[model samples]
Target: MSHDAIVLCRLDELVEGQALGFDPLGTGKDSVFALRHGGEVRVYRNSCPHLEVRLEYRKDRFLSVDGSQIICYAHGARFLPDSGLCVYGPCLGQSLSALRWHAEADWLVLEAGQLEACAP
Candidate 1:
């Protein structure tokens, strides 16, 4: 139940119904993005399952117009906001990769050790 965690951001920074991208490794590209949905924060790897490409059309633009679904700009796939499940386009039935995280106080923390284990 103990691990070294890295704070992604203050919870308030994650605006409701909007996507916020994070470059955890300082790679000059976003490795993941977070969204606030139904009073919860959901974090997902930025990659599109169809082609393994980053999903955003531009910085932090992961959701469709009106912010209802996750849109993979590279492949035109649509995913359920809460579940990351691709429901349309080429990768239908495939899901975006979710990262392990939990909110602590006013911050969102990625469970770091597990993330290291999962990193390529």
Candidate 2:
């Protein structure tokens, strides 16, 4: 992967409508989630908007039933695929903070200046 690009798992490793957390670029508790929906991939901070904590059922597991929505294991909040908008729970109309990335040469490259501080 390029220095500016995120290390996207191989297509064989990620099924549709699933999300996996990526380690922080450096060393920290902070991390990002790479979500796959159809043929598109969206990246966001791994924290749930409702509680600002990591959301996963297990290691790198962050998908809701039917594998169509992102679910917060902390409080069961649901977010829409692709948009990252909260569709239920206390988050209401809020959205997950996104990081911009592009697929190049079969890798997901995190765009320059696109990383942002996530809500805490």
Candidate 3:
């Protein structure tokens, strides 16, 4: 079977210690986000575990002030960038949904079917 190819962004476009969100499905809201931490790229669903709300306060604003943690502005929950662990806040002991992806040349990508399986 074949699936539509989806490219989130270019590897070089990802600044270390920052998160970039994408709406690959055109859901009008970002469905997932990716960030570079410790020289590796990690991706996770954009929703917070506490209330299923988008994790950013504004576009590409998923990190805390220091860029050390992912912050869900809705409830002030903080998460570890590498593991999506809700280290502090209402969702403590829980984690954001993670997505597995692979990079192709300069693009960070996923197949349409892969994202569809991860969608709600």
Best-matching candidate per lDDT: 3
Looking at model 3, the pairs that clash are none
Per-prediction count of colliding residue pairs?
A: 0, 3, 0
Q: Mark the 10 consecutive residues where model 1 has the least summed lDDT.
A: 111-120
> What's the candidate order when arranged by decreasing TM-score?
3, 1, 2
Rank ordering of all candidates by lDDT, starting from the highest: 3, 1, 2
lDDT of each: 0.85, 0.74, 0.87
**Candidate No. with top TM-score:** 3
- Which scores higher on lDDT, 1 or 2? 1
In candidate 1, how many Å is residue 114 off?
Answer: 3.9
Off by over 4 Å in 3: 1-4, 117-120
Structural similarity to truth (TM-score) of each candidate = 0.90, 0.81, 0.91
The TM-score of predicted model 1 comes to: 0.90
**Candidate 2 stretches greater than 4 Å from native:** 1-3, 26-30, 116-120
Candidate RMSDs in Å, in order, are 2.1, 2.6, 2.0
The CA lDDT at 35 in model 3 is 95
Clashing pairs in 2: 5-109, 5-110, 6-110
